[model samples]
Target: MDEQIITGATAAEITASVRTLHERGALRPGDALPPVRELAALLGVNRNTAVAAYRLLAQAGVVVARGRAGTVIAGHEAVAQEGYAPDSVLRDIGTGNPDPRLIPDPTTALARATGRPVLYGEPVIDPALEDRALAWVRDDLPGRDLRITVTSGAVDAVERLLAQALLRDDAVALEDPCFLASIHTVRLGGYRAVPVPVDSEGMTVDGLRAALDDGVRAIICTPRAQNPTGATLSPRRAADLRALLAEHPYVLVIEDDHFSMLSQRPYETLIGPEHRRFALVRSVSKFLGPDMCLAIAATDPETAERLALRLSPGTTWVSHLLQRLVLAQLTDGTVLHAIAAAGRHYAERNAAFAAHLTERGLPTEAEDGLNLWVALPVAAKTVAERLVLRGWLARTGDEFVLSERSAPSHHLRLTVHDLTDEETARLIDDLAESTR
Candidate 1:
């Protein structure tokens, strides 16, 4: 065991020591530290000091406390990120955004939105748009009791949902290596985020149950193309999660299927057929363009009514014009075709990049969605530094971490697959060089 991880006389120092080691790649995920008694002896502190340090780390989702197994870094939890430097000379592979070039041109849709102005006291939802939203969302929702509510975007719907269902400091379960926007929303809303680790098969049952046991009032999940990780919940995993959640049926479950039309993955759901208090949100941002700013939120009636209170009168109904534009685009054959083509483009390019990396012994696979989640042998921060020297800007794994901000992560969620074959090859070689 590394003795230096236990040097601090104070609780904060002990925790910070482990953080420093993890950040610079000295400590690794799932690696165990000394036992509490051993750590206390090494630091010449009270046993409570070691216990407090480990408790703090565990609370932050940085470490797990297993009886007899000691404390180990918590792995596979998700979080959000920051963008690349604005004026950098490097080719940025860091931005997690969908390429604007692929966003369907909305000029045609906007111009074709011939709907008349909407007035107050008019039905909150435009009759035609609501019908369209209902049709588009109904198949994915498991229950007939689901109602439609429109929000500016998926983020808006999420914020409204949590605001309606939870009080300040209420615990909310979030996927580890989580969606950045959800993390931001949860924090800004003053709710507590309990990180639930997500694997390739999607959110781990153990993580969700663990959070639920902690009395989390709400859960926000991405059923497909999970942000940063590109994890799509498998059918079996979805079923298992649903079964576990069945015991806690009234806890609010919100599914943000952000990549609906553009996603290649199957629509597996955790809002089981009988599960009450659920919301399924699908946004048009990834396909129709972020400028569209339209999303259809399907939820149980009570949740919908609570969410609707926030969207009343003139305060915040989605613009009638924007709604019509989204409808026009969704209905237009050409626009739908463009969205399909863009989806194929993202998958193919990501697959190509993943394949090249694997050939070079990096062992990557572009499973789904826009970005390729690439694992590196070296710490991601170290690899990112080398990429910067080589004129490439990549997002380090730490950028998306929620609690364990400096965990020694060896992955990069890169959106650089649009690079030329030569550029991809050179970048892969540079990555290997940096690790070596």
Candidate 2:
């Protein structure tokens, strides 16, 4: 036991040992390691040596110091193991992820721009990016008084908007079974979330009316491709919502057009001109790669000014390098081509799966965006568990539901874009079997 310690007394050696433990699966994500005092005593080293080693590991992303929760492994074993698959046996059908093949390679453009040193106080959002983004957003958000602010992502934009608009304990209306991120964001900010119902035509006007009646100060609505459901708001529904919102003119309406570029459905503007406060956030992460992390937030001058105040140049301005990269791809015609191909691919694949389910006597239909929302005869979690047993990972509808005491629906959000025909058919068959 005395001879088991690695001979080197240096801090670098201790850090290397900790990293080796993580690399070899001896440490795993969320697993708390020995305390600094305990490790120091065991290794016959000073407490400072152990502290420095842990800090080095944290910097390298090998471990995280969780304060009272203690230091723990940061990366999962699956991440460390090359090609290690999760328990999901079926091909990945759960995640609402874009096809990696469609993301155009940015390395070529990034390399060309690597020659310059990005200095502080320099323009954060690239001028070229601003020009192109403004033009692109204007296509969907047509109005004379709109101003744009660049953000890290759609989620980032939403968070900042909430920060600027609401104080702690304020109520924000969100679609019931909302996108999980929205739920987490609102909760983390200590705001109350008022649930609004979503139907085939997207968020219901009556639900919004109820939320407003309940005194919600803000509302986040997805006009098309409502996550986990793939429901697009019909024109009639949008008009109805606009009419309802007219009664409550002061409520802030945030229309998240996350699927703007990839959606095959017709665009419907829910934030009517009469509505005094609104912001339309469109993110490129769905159509482009998530690594780009760029979104354009358009609002009226007043709201824009408030949002802009939160985005001071000193704090968090969108990175110029990232902005330039997005601008290069967006303007090159290559990104548009890729988006067209991806949209077609998604539509065809989703249609094929829906057809297979229909043939099996299950009701199914194809919709826009990268994934399909399928209804099953059982609870979504049960269906998801069965799918996992069959080697496929799927997202349960409950994860997106924001309502309380509502009967759980048997719905699974499937990413069918990259599945082969045979694989798609097999999945349908397995799903049929699983439901039974």
Candidate 3:
């Protein structure tokens, strides 16, 4: 790593030089960057200018700061996402997906989804869908300055909301044992994640207060049916969080209610009536199927305006057909009944499985989500390894943790709602054996 390769008079120029050097193979990943003072002296610039240059590069995902180790070149790595293993023979019980059998058939709604052709300059959201969504969303988010915007899904909406409000390197408070997509999005965007611990009552008050004290610009919370852990926010817990957040009135709050329709628990929120900034996102993927690729965001007027800037008029807006399809299914009597039945089915299956674990001396509770978070007597990694040997693939709770200082997770998140009675019994037996 020759200091001579880095030559520039200004911060932008220095950033460009490093990018060019990396492109030309002169600089590689893990290469050390010169310290701020040394680089400043070499370029005859102030130390602040040198620091700014490095910050720019870090924001671009081209470099990472390592404190005493100084700055180093960084390489992009593919993030793990939620889905089935492409060609694996093992039964995957870890993928956080809805049961396909429970998802209502979309074919019947396709014809109803068809309508008059929409032009480029027309409104982005379908009139019918918007009308239905407003009524439905209003029930949950009552009495606030609200506006509805659509995106590909809950993940897309969160990304857009963060992009609209945050700068690179800004801190965002995320739930520990977070949703996979949130972890991936924060890492890729080059933003810092502050871990806020979640218990049976969702985000803890002290954890959120700490994140706020750390000067997080934003917070992403799952109010109901939190992923991986299946934690829901109790009314008292929500009130405590809202009271704490009231002090930092301007910190943006984004609540993701991904299991809106399928959740058996009541919906509780972190946003206060007088809170200045927020977004509440609900996606149809859970009940309508993932391929539908549509979600509605109810956000503050200013936030909605800022988010709209990222979505171009004609090309980037969510498809009208998808919105119509969701609206049709939502309004249909038969589809609503089916969705309600599916919710009960998931609760019943998880309870049965939890009882099985309890009978075997491993105390467990059936939480209110599609997955069961099981605590093993031993390390979850040991059990996962044993499960793999027995033709079962499970996701360990360690993958969702935000900080290394947190205790080693002895938990596994299992999606076993779709499993038959015989299959469930076999899995319970295998889990018991694995712990031994």
Q: Candidate 2, which ten residues in sequence have the lowest lDDT sum?
A: 76-85
Q: Report the alpha-carbon TM-score of model 1 versus the true structure.
A: 0.80
**Per-residue alpha-carbon lDDT of candidate 3 for residues 326-425, written as tens digits (9 for 90 to 100):** 8889999999999999999999989999999999988888988899999988999999999999999999998888866546789999999999888898
Q: Whole-model lDDT, candidate 3?
A: 0.91
Instruction: Show where candidate 1 strays beyond 4 Å.
Output: 1-84, 403-406
- Judged by whole-model lDDT over C-alpha atoms, candidate 2 comes out at 0.77
Per-residue lDDT tens digits for candidate 2, residues 90-169, read 57776677888887778766754443656667655666666776786676666547788899999899998888888765
Q: What are the candidates' C-alpha RMSDs?
A: 8.9, 11.4, 1.9
Q: What's each prediction's clash count?
A: 8, 7, 0
Model 1, 136-182: lDDT tens digits are 87877744777899899999999999999986657899998877799
Q: List the residue pairs that clash in candidate 2.
A: 89-391, 90-391, 90-392, 176-402, 177-400, 177-401, 177-402
Select the stronger candidate by TM-score from 1 and 3.
Answer: 3
Report the candidate with higher TM-score, 2 versus 3: 3
Q: Which should have the higher lDDT, number 2 or number 3?
A: 3
lDDT of each: 0.84, 0.77, 0.91
